[model samples]
Target: MVLLSCLQRCIQLLIWPVYILAYMGLWDSFYKRVFPYIMARFAPIYNQKVCKQKQELFSNLRKFAGPSGQLRLLEIGTGTGTNFQFYPPGCQLTCTDPNPNFRQFLLKSLSENPHVQLERSVVASGENLHEVPDGAVDVVVCTLVLCSVTNVSKVLKEVLRVLRLGGAFYFLEHVAADQSSWTYFWQKVCDPAWKCFGDGCSLSRETQKELEKTNFSELNLRRIHVAPRWSPTSPHIIGYAVK
Candidate 1:
């Protein structure tokens, strides 16, 4: 028993570095190409389930956004620019991602959509957003990105800094399981493996809690389960917030 315990600890100790490297080399490439393809094919179905929620979000946004209906929107992890189709017309969209391959694809997609002015940069969450000015952006959108960032608090702070007062932060994310038993089991069993292959996505992260810690005001949050054909998990949190 003692030998087995020692072996387990040793193996666990070595997992993180191996996980990080594998994430950069293998999973990044796979996600850049494959995730977009999967999302593009299924976007119609996915959009249908979330239409009501999106309507509520847009309703609230329209009230704050004023008559021009033109807003400066920033998307943190604009993977292959799949979400661009959802943005209201007259949005000046700026997208950033660390993956160069994904950025190229995102730019190409942006060109096809003439309404959006594309700015591509190799930016990762928790890093400085020097290109975007403080209090300049009207809206910030993050979907399924908090799970992958290196430091959630830092990224949230940067997001808050960029948005003007009364500006909103829109998000749709998968969070830590609310049920402790299921959360513990997944955390114990899958987190290490998931961190390796899922690009630092933590199955146990409570994104709502993290958002609450930020400076954003009048936060309206909703939680929903997203049944994606590709993802094994059915319960995901989909909601929006205001800055």
Candidate 2:
């Protein structure tokens, strides 16, 4: 327990610098450019596990991947194209991210996933997807995205606007932990620092709840737990909501 105590203290001590960087607006560059480099090493394994855990949910999405009536998939905040392997052939994917730094990594993944045609690589945020048209997308894939958006509700509305009738929005995101837990308290306390370095990742964001508030014909969500290294990424939800 002594080692755990020391680790906690170290984390507490380190938060101050992150706060300073965020306030100074320097964290944005670090988050966009530097963080992806570090994440490229670990995110693949984490994302693969996430996919495996949500395999049943993902199978439903596979139905859209076919030559006849190819699905137009809009993946918001497509960080390093981590979800590439999950997609099957004949998917017309339009990837968007505010950070241009991820372009190279995303391109590499897209090149490997030749099955899914790269429709567009827009350097834009989820809040404003003007590059994509209304009622154009069949599936809006938003994994690990809502937590960082400037406005979750607004983003959801935008998503609803873009999806055609009966289109599905598949989401896998880490939400705020249970209110009574120490994890919740710690998450709340560390949110600012977490957002600073984590590219706007808010540990306390109730993303699934935000999804519930949206105008979906049906909302199906399930909670999940990941791990310590990805402590902020735990207490997640994986499911789809039909528009």
Candidate 3:
């Protein structure tokens, strides 16, 4: 407990500097240029750890082919295109991210994964995907996104607005640990600094609860614990909601 307390204090100490950077408006630029590289290195490890779960969740995507007979998929927070490998071949993918720097990396991934063609890449937030038409996509995907969004409910509302009738929204996100657990205590303790350094990721957001309140016609969410229990990001939920 002493060591944990020390760790918590250290994290708290780091956030003041992050606040200063953000105040100066340098934080967004810094994250834009650097976060893609960071995810490039971290994604493989995370993908491997969640490989089975991703396969299970992604497999349930209804094959609602567009007029072109290709699955139309819109992936919000398409950081570095990390989930590209798991997408079905011939998917007409539209990608979105608040950070524009990720576009090059996304294009690189698109070139490498020739089977999935890019319909467009928009520099937009999850809460405002106005460029995408109503019922424009057959599937919407968001992985590790809800924790960082400014408004989770608004994003969910936008998601429902954009999906075609019977369309599915598949999400995989690390959420707040169970309230009675040791991890939950640490998550609350570390959230302030985590948001500062993690580009607005909240360590203790009850994302699953938000999903429950969303009016999806069918919701199938499951809570599971990933390995490395000491990490605040270990507790996760993966599932889909249909419009």
TM-score of each: 0.76, 0.88, 0.92
Candidate ranking under lDDT, highest first, comes to 3, 2, 1
The C-alpha RMSD of each candidate to the native structure, in angstroms, is: 4.9, 3.9, 2.4
* Candidate 3 accuracy as lDDT: 0.88
Candidate 1 Cα misplacement greater than 4 A, ranges? 1-60, 66-69, 119-122, 228-232
Of 1 and 3, the candidate ranking higher by lDDT: 3
Model 3 per-residue lDDT at 110: 85
**lDDT tens string, model 2, 1-243?**
464466656676888776677689886666667877877787888876776765666677855433456888999999888887787677888899888888888989988888888988898889999888898888999988898899999899889998988888998888898887778767766775677667778998888778877989999888878776347557888889998
Between the candidate structures 1 and 3, which one is better when assessed by TM-score? 3
Worst ten-residue run, lDDT, model 2? 60-69
Give each model's clash number: 0, 0, 0
Best by lDDT: 3
Q: How well does candidate 2 score on lDDT at residue 73?
A: 91
Error of 1 at 114 (Å): 3.2
For model 1, where is the 10-residue window of minimal lDDT? 226-235
lDDT for every model? 0.68, 0.81, 0.88
